[model samples]
Target: MKRKPPTISPEDSELFRDAIGDVRRIEAEPAAPARPGPPPEPRRLRIDEEEALRESRRAPADLALDAADLLSYCRPGLPERVFRQLKRGEYSIQDEIDLHHLRAADAEALLKQFLNAARRGHHPCVRIVHGKGLRSEGAPVLKSLVDRVLRHRGDVLAFASAPLNQGGSGAVLVLLDER
Candidate 1:
């Protein structure tokens, strides 16, 4: 057995229509599916295989000197006076990165990143402590590596060994290009 839907009476329907004046229908679009999970991790920069090979082939003599005093380099045309001030550690270091116990490759990568970051941050001056070769076998490995890397970076305006009180011959005062 089934029951039929009730029908409205003519007068009652008229009263109901008058009460509910106008009506409309609407359709909605389907929503997109949710993403699977967290976003993918960013890729890290790495030294090219060829560049690493070239670097590995570099001889000790070719990379840096065995000098005992200050290590320095100033891009051509920069004021000599400014370089002199750097040598004297006259400029206040805004930040510093110490490569005290890091391996050569690690120190180099850290130094490159640090210099780029310093330049991007508009830091005018910074210090790098590459520790004297006191614990090193022969010449200071990190110090030599630091000297080479700093000299090669275009953002480096000038760099010189820090003053005696500031880790002389072990640390360097670097002047970066203004952003």
Candidate 2:
């Protein structure tokens, strides 16, 4: 037979209750484990991946701009004199953007956006100030990126380094198609 627990006598229980302090109850519940969520979006591109993508979507031969050389390009069929005038700062700048401290990727994206907006607004001329690589470890990163992107864009009619007072080699004067 199962043994029963010894019961306290009423007088003993009263004596125990008097010895012990009053007790309180809590209404809180235990927390459950958190569920997993979806994976995060990718942010950075690997060097090789970036190079490969750039190569695959490379601009046509006539439109490609070199990074090492002077920043200048004009779509075929445009008058060479027009580019010369652009180099001399003859065109009035309708808008401008500075890419001084931005990374290569960010500079490229901003340039693309800026060009799009300029074109939409029918801005004939714009200035892009890409600082000289004085602070960079090697070649001017933003300057080269701007050169490449500007050359590849169909909306870009031509681009040339700005005049001395306007920033010289550290900046570019971009001519965008009216459309």
Candidate 3:
């Protein structure tokens, strides 16, 4: 599909030159001395966040927790009645995350992110289904991870194993503190 460009005959070229009379070469004004662009916007926050994410992805130290055992925690100063309510699954779960088959590190990261987002969205309660880790080689990895992570988070006011009708010991109902 390539076509050769139409070339003017030598006579036509000479006619064109004659018609033009005279010409002078014009120089491009030297490209205004290349000024450096504005310094790159600071990425300190993004870099720090990336580093933290990477750190969070590293496998957390394992904890001893059986797959069938119920999990629960109430932050100091949280009322016993509130913890009891969480255990009863009385609070409507506004959100949920299932970490059924995910690895420990990935589950930890996702659990943290989900909790943070839930807190920011003003969700008072959420459920996490860690699946009782029935397929794990040794201890239930994700169940233990969820327990550890929730305990350390400042916004997690209380958490307990869901009641039998609501996934029983396989999932937890969490009560989050208002942000």
Model 3 is weakest, by summed lDDT over 10 consecutive residues, at 41-50
**Could you arrange the candidates by lDDT from highest to lowest?**
3, 1, 2
Q: What TM-score do all the candidates reach, one by one? A: 0.67, 0.63, 0.66
Q: How close is candidate 2 to the true structure, as a TM-score?
A: 0.63
Model 2 C-alpha lDDT versus the unseen true structure: 0.79
Candidate that beats the other on TM-score, 1 or 2, i.e. the better one? 1
Q: Name the runs in model 2 displaced over 4 angstroms.
A: 1-53, 56-69
Candidate 1, superposed: residue stretches over 4 Å from native: 1-64
**What is the total number of backbone clashes in candidate 3?**
0
On residues 85-105, what C-alpha lDDT tens digit does candidate 1 reach at each position? 999889988989999999998
Candidate 1 colliding pairs: none
Model 1 lDDT vs. the true structure?
Answer: 0.80
Q: Rank the candidates by TM-score, best first.
A: 1, 3, 2
Number of the top-ranking candidate, with lDDT as the measure:
3
lDDT of each: 0.80, 0.79, 0.84
Worst 10 residues of 1 by lDDT: 41-50
Residues 1-179 of candidate 2 have per-residue lDDT tens digits of 99999998999999888889697888788798788898764333234335544763664445433333468788998999998899899999999999999988888778777877887798989999988877776567787678777755666789999898998888999998885
